[model samples]
Target: MSSTNRRDFLRASAAAALSAAVPADLFAQSETAQSSPGAIWDSGSVRHLLPTVSDSRMLIKVSFTAPVEGEPRLHVGDLTVRGSMGDTRGEHWHFYATDLGPGRRYPLSLVGSNGRALCQPWELATFPGPDERPNRFRLLIYTCGGGHEVHKFLPTAVRNRLLRRGLSFQPDAMIANGDHVYWDLLAPVGSRLLGAAPEAVKAAGTFDRSAIVLGSDNETVLKRAAGPQIVPVYGTDFRSTPVFFLQDDHDYFDNDEATDEVVTFPPSYFMLQLARATQGIYYPEFLPDSARPLGLPWSSGRDRAWGVSESFGTLRFGRLAEILLYDVRRTQTMAGPSAVYIDPAVEKWLKARTAATEVAHVVHVPSNPPGWTAGKWGEWYPDVLGREGKLTTNEPKPYWQPGWLKQHDRLIEAMAAVKGRAPLVISGDLHAIAIGRMLRSGRLDLKDNPVNVVLSGPLGSRPGPLGWPSGRRGTGAMPSAHLDMEEQVKPIEQHGFTVADFTREKIVLRLFKWDIKTQPVEAIDTLQPFHTAELTRPA
Candidate 1:
């Protein structure tokens, strides 16, 4: 054979041998992997791994130890779906896959540029389709889950152990009602009192508008501020469970306080920017629901296109129940009589959902609670802490808006009007585990159809001394003067969560709690719920 023909034949033979040695799928994956430096993977490199799944879709948020060099890929079943960088910084990436089968558990894994698995494979199941009715559904609910770096009020070990105990129940899903990040820039405990390391403590001083968040020098400070609060506490514990994270006042880096100098809520432009950046990196946004209509206020282009929402969300578990989740802090306004904690459009959507009969049960999960108040400025009632340290409406709260109370009345009335199923509201923000039935609000009387409210306790906060670090409200959560409530389980200050079991007949709520000083460390492993409240369908 000629020299040229011999070289061609050798090249073809080498190519054929290489293809035979590699698996067909891996070879195909390598072809699509980005032609750039990529993220290095070890079992510990992924600092945070969380996924949120809908009936036919799943969105996974993966945060690496360092900025990723190229796009990551998710391998599920027979598909190799490409992922996009999810944050301004390169550390966080997202993998969104659609066309998944409803109610089916699919094993998923991440692959690098070399076509090798980055970590062990895990299984995630999609929710049952809207029309399909599963026998039972269970949800794990909690709030104020963020902890400071300096204080051991809620040590990392205790927080993880408590969550592990709750996970032992094998809940179908989890809802972190609000206040997921507690780095309150204005609070003394968050500012000067935290026990963080010297250098680390220095970085938490003040917000720097000079540097862009997640993509600039602020990235280091942001990580130092939020990383320990979230990463170590959750780790990979929630890798398999779908988590619905709702943001509140603290998530925006401020407390819901109104002082002569400033009103911390109605988040400022910078606070909003930081909140968005934090969420984009640490967790997944709410999956889109077709029932939630279009043209909702502040609907970003990406949010509208993907049908995902940043503030409003829905947890539709077959036809057994439909839970509407809304963040009260994000879009709150201060237009006096025109003021609203939620947009008028969102309020309309909420009322419509409350009145719907297709679902056996309808529940409202708001970032703010209604039945009780801690005498805070941002509340449904204009109650303030009396000189004696108790919530009293004798003196109107300073800077409190009247519209908030009006909107609260409208929502309660809507829930009361529902037929067949009992009206229920499960809320977070108040650091207590309590259940009450609101028979009246302002002039509106929900006498015949009382609104059931549940404060699904705090997971990471402690009721300790130095109330600021402990996150214990000054007056605790108490029934406001205008509210006529039947307090089933009065507000109890402790670190805990609620487990709710939903069926067509009724809903059962179990409250589990533990005190850092009282409960032995080992006792956490076998901790059982302390209170149980059952609400049945209307006769």
Candidate 2:
């Protein structure tokens, strides 16, 4: 059968199933009806759920504690769609509905084969159509949400409290920039903080490195290591909100380090598989974009079918704003002169999006932060730690590739070239809250139209012994070499997140901070933005 015919047949079958599964009285209600507040919620079978939405698609991942007895379907008012089982162990289920109405709210529930509700009925709204413009769009943005095993620096309870506070503002969506999990199997400092016995760590390293994560012994080990970091903190609190999760160095089960004995970047095949498995089980893949080709890096033929890119994604809010999301760690290469922190294809796509005027505002959300470097081997700049733990370019940074800097300059130039819009970049990896502009990069000068960057605050970092790895690198984020720039909000090591509001006239950012040492735990409930900056659209 042709593709058109296949789609028609499936649609008819779904309608028939919906007629049979849904009650006659319930089917009378409109698909866009409001969610029932007093609906029965089943927290036993469905432990948790997270959803991702686009202009016309909604993808939800549900976790079950026990095996599902029969086929489960997602009931969205009068419409019912079948759920696809995920993972070999049968705990994860994915319900994907496409060709949904744009900018419409859908109240949905999951019903089992026996016609019992599996989860609470929740509401999710799709994005506006491509040509349409929204008056306002709000996002809850944060980074470094993961924590060390034994470290209580921003424990799960505290993280949830912060997230609930952010939710109170009722953000349209959430962007978890990077470092969602922190169980580094390698790297010296991280390994010691694994909070596991030395023997157990050794066993995990050997077994996980040799096994495929999907069906083999590695899946359980991967779950044991990653589940605690993600499931507990996020839980079902985000059931009504769409989340975009970007992976960084720690998400690959190690830090980006290059020492004499081992180089931890350009993730090994096992590391890549483990990362894939973790995302496959926990989160939703990025929805498809017509502008982004499937041949891009970290994409497979199977991924092409789903139209999802694991490393590159787009969060478009109507014609008002388009935020490009890219993972700078997974596809990075270290081939000397050609080494790149992001795939060249991704760079090309980013440049094209940056230059496009389809959206009133264009923002870049990379897992790797620009503007400041911590004198690390994986950073774009070649700066190294000087005396008194200051960053300086005089000392050569070992294992630092020059190609990374070249690519960074090209991207900066592309963002600056855009007319009538601020070249805004929000990222999180540096573990600090900072706002700056790249006035000059190497020989390229962005002084006329500087590229603005914001280091979205870390959500789970602390100071002293329980702080982020950067706490050991230096005092905080510092200006790297070869760049002339001005720091508006100088880097401050604090635990917080950024709330950004995108509008046609301007983009407003409210940066919130909470110091675990200086502030009381209850202060998190009423934390306010310490600073607010507005970038008005160019005339």
Candidate 3:
């Protein structure tokens, strides 16, 4: 109880406090992380995916701030699947548990290397196998996001209404067809600039916009945003459903403005590297063998100033449907009809799948609709020329430029070759909700086939479709061969998702829409789709 004893106690307390402090390091390695364990990745980085395949399998992955010092295994039901943190994204650890049994639901949690419960478990749902014919299933497609921290960057009520819809019509699986999150800013808030529209920041893929939501150089920031800001929007459904995400221009660069030159792409060198590393941290690709596979993202040789990835591939589901996921941003032609949107490999794969006699349908998931949407930025439409390569405009440099039109026809021809199943093109971009039948007879027609093109997008943005009162956002749509016999049904330009119900016989599509400006969450609780249409196999 003497003054000397009190002094000794104070010294010990001070030493412990110093050792336990967590340093505010962004991406720093540390021996004294107990006080402030530098993040290898942020807490709770769980991502779910249903690998493209006819069979059932689910993939669950988590990114850790640092590699687990010991072992990391995921426990689902009575089965234990070992996970490895050997993968790194700028010192951050990526742990994956893939190819787990499909068709059953299970609660998943982490069992640490040291034999302790590392984190809470989540419920996962896998798909059915190839030989299986899933008469029908609903899939939620999300795309064209506002950005990482929607709260900070804009006042828009960023919401994903389809995710919140309960068990009644909740989707069986989900597809994030790119425009997932925006990360164009290179500096902190104080040193950055922004644009009027989210796209404006790229200033239409020409300007440098700055805003700090996460770190271009730090995995922790991106993980934190994905955990709290991004993940939950899918809500409890994410606990049980599978999600597949593909990258677009935004996921790669700020936004891609398809000028006449592929060599002049804005994001090159370190900027591309930052984008690639950040992307690697968030959406690591996991392709199952059962899903028809193809080569992955690759470099355009020197153009890859950012990252190298193979974002195009295919998945065939039994004899029911085939899913074709292509990277429009990277593969897009440097200029015009012959530019080569389908890398010869991708086209070959598409043609082979189309030729397959078994599959009844093809679900084509492209980043943007094959062409432009009259509802939003119609002039930016690329396929202005008709099937015969006849120009519609007489201007020297018209409002829109030429693009992969020839290749576009090739894509549809391949689709027509898809023996039994009518190709269903589901896409994202142009913050409008429009389901249309392509006008093949028009001068601007896509082709002679009945390929139906649908839009599912703006999971985060303005709540209404582009032209609301009429709700015919897509009636007089761009004439792409893909949507030849098209009719605009309930073209309500609003924030929403499209659910396509598929069976061996037909695929009926329903557009589920929402309004944050009015009902907020109340808008999504509906048994009926805002609009619905049916498509049967061609006779």
lDDT of 3 by residue, 250-367 (tens): 5553444323432323345544454454444444443444334424435322322112234664454455766777766555545543456556766776677667676677777877
Please list the residue runs of candidate 2 whose C-alpha ends up more than 4 Å from where it truly belongs after superposition: 1-44, 195-206, 300-305
Residue 426 of model 1 has an lDDT of 95
Q: What C-alpha lDDT, on a 0 to 100 scale, does residue 436 get in candidate 1? A: 90
TM-score of each: 0.88, 0.89, 0.70
Clashing pairs in 2: none
Show where candidate 1 strays beyond 4 Å: 1-44, 187-200, 203-206, 298-305, 467-473
Models sorted by lDDT, best on top: 2, 1, 3
lDDT of 2 by residue, 1-539 (tens): 58565434323321111111123133134434432221233343676688888998888888887778778899765778887776777788888788888888777777788776665456677888888978888888999988744455468778877787677555788999888877777776666665254644553433447656778877777766777677767777777778898899888878888888888888988778877877788888788877787778766437322777788888988899898999989888888888898887889889988889889998999998889887878888888887757778888777889888888888988998986888899998888898988888888878788888999988877556446445567545677777887999988888888888877999988888888778887777676778989889889
Supply the global lDDT for candidate 2. 0.77
Task: Determine which window of 10 residues in candidate 3 has minimal summed lDDT.
Answer: 13-22
